[model samples]
Target: MDRKILIYPRGNGEGKGNSMSMFLCLDETTLPPDTKLFVKFLLRVISQTPTKSDDFEFKVENHFGPSCLNWGAQKFMSIVKLNDPKKGYLVGDTCIAEANVTLIGEVTTAS
Candidate 1:
């Protein structure tokens, strides 16, 4: 499966200015026309601190297709919490984001 991770540091849509937005996006161009995918995915922001890692994570299952290529949380994590040093999400001005996706099934129209 061809997939990509999308993150908005300043957030997106509803999350803008309040939290970070993260999403799993299916590459529609790589898929056959009228194809749909059922997928389970996990998205995380890894803490960079050496002492402890308080990761922020979200998981969900959804369908993706040409019309719906993306699915994820609008409020993945609060901006204040992510930027706080105590949270350990950002260290030395760097933060790590991860995505794990599993393809549960696929369907395609017989055209």
Candidate 2:
């Protein structure tokens, strides 16, 4: 099934906050079946500069399990994927977050 990705972040100086909005694109088939993975994909794409590595990067955190200990932010940085380089979504959550968010064709990754 195709999923609509959604993310909300609060930070930075207004006029440019949206520039830092994170984006994630998963190759659909990578996600496991019958299982809901609560993950946050943080992406920092350099639109105008055209650089290889970002000056900053967004973080995707997934929460799962009873204690939700497995889905901490520590695992996020290592798992997030950028569209330009196109690494695809990386899943490593042993726990699910309280957020059961569905992606809705975001402005960031839709390009």
Candidate 3:
């Protein structure tokens, strides 16, 4: 399956979930350490098929737009694993879609 690395929230508060609601997210830095719950991590495309060693992760990024209070971008943690859309691309229906990421993660643990 075609896949990418996805960054998301660790919990439900501060804006996080299927809603894609505006939320404050952290920049490349400022992410907390020693996080046992969830943290952001970027990795290369791992596969085109499912594998046994596929490990995925997401971090809480500050919210965006007016609803999220335009926190600009901060950081949080992730609590879910999103799958590819059966009929749409990742983070679709946006002006700057190519630059926007709906979700991301390794695919099949390709080596």
Candidate 4:
């Protein structure tokens, strides 16, 4: 299955504060049947310009549990704290963020 990764800004509905996060997910239709596996991945994000960065390392197992029709998305790096000025999360009066994702491996059931 093909996986897509991306980054975006999130804010409370009340307009309290905004934060950055990453989403790693795959298409459920392509999941191998009657099998369970562990997905190891890394998500990295950096300023589109030149500035700070962030990353997450973890594994997603039981992604195809019965409760979910689709494998669904795995969200990470929420509530990221961004410092203004030096960090330059926003520069040139523009906000730019880039995301990169690497799928390390998928350990499937032996039987």
Judged by TM-score relative to the true structure, which candidate is superior, 2 or 4? 4
lDDT (Cα atoms) of all candidates against the true structure:
0.88, 0.32, 0.27, 0.44
Q: Where does candidate 3 stray beyond 4 Å?
A: 1-84, 91-111
Every model's TM-score? 0.92, 0.25, 0.17, 0.48
Error of 2 at 102 (Å): 16
**Candidate 4 has which clashing residue pairs, if any?**
none
lDDT of 2 by residue, 23-79 (tens): 333434644433444555444423222342333344556533223322212212222
The pairs that clash in candidate 1 are none
lDDT of 1 at 83: 89
Local error of candidate 2 at residue 99 (angstroms)? 18
* Model 3 weakest lDDT span, ten residues long: 90-99
Residue lDDT tens for model 3, 1-111: 122223332323454453222232334322223211122223221222334143322234332221222232222222222234321222232111111333333222223
lDDT of 1 by residue, 1-111 (tens): 688889898899999999989999888789888889888899999987775558889999999988998999889999999889988897777888999888899999876
- List residue ranges in candidate 1 displaced over 4 A: none
Model 1: per-residue Cα lDDT at residue 101? 85
Model 2, residue 5: distance off in Å is: 4.8
User: Cα lDDT of model 3 overall?
Assistant: 0.27
TM-score, model 3 to reference? 0.17
Q: Model 2, which residues run further than 4 Å from truth?
A: 4-35, 38-40, 53-55, 63-111
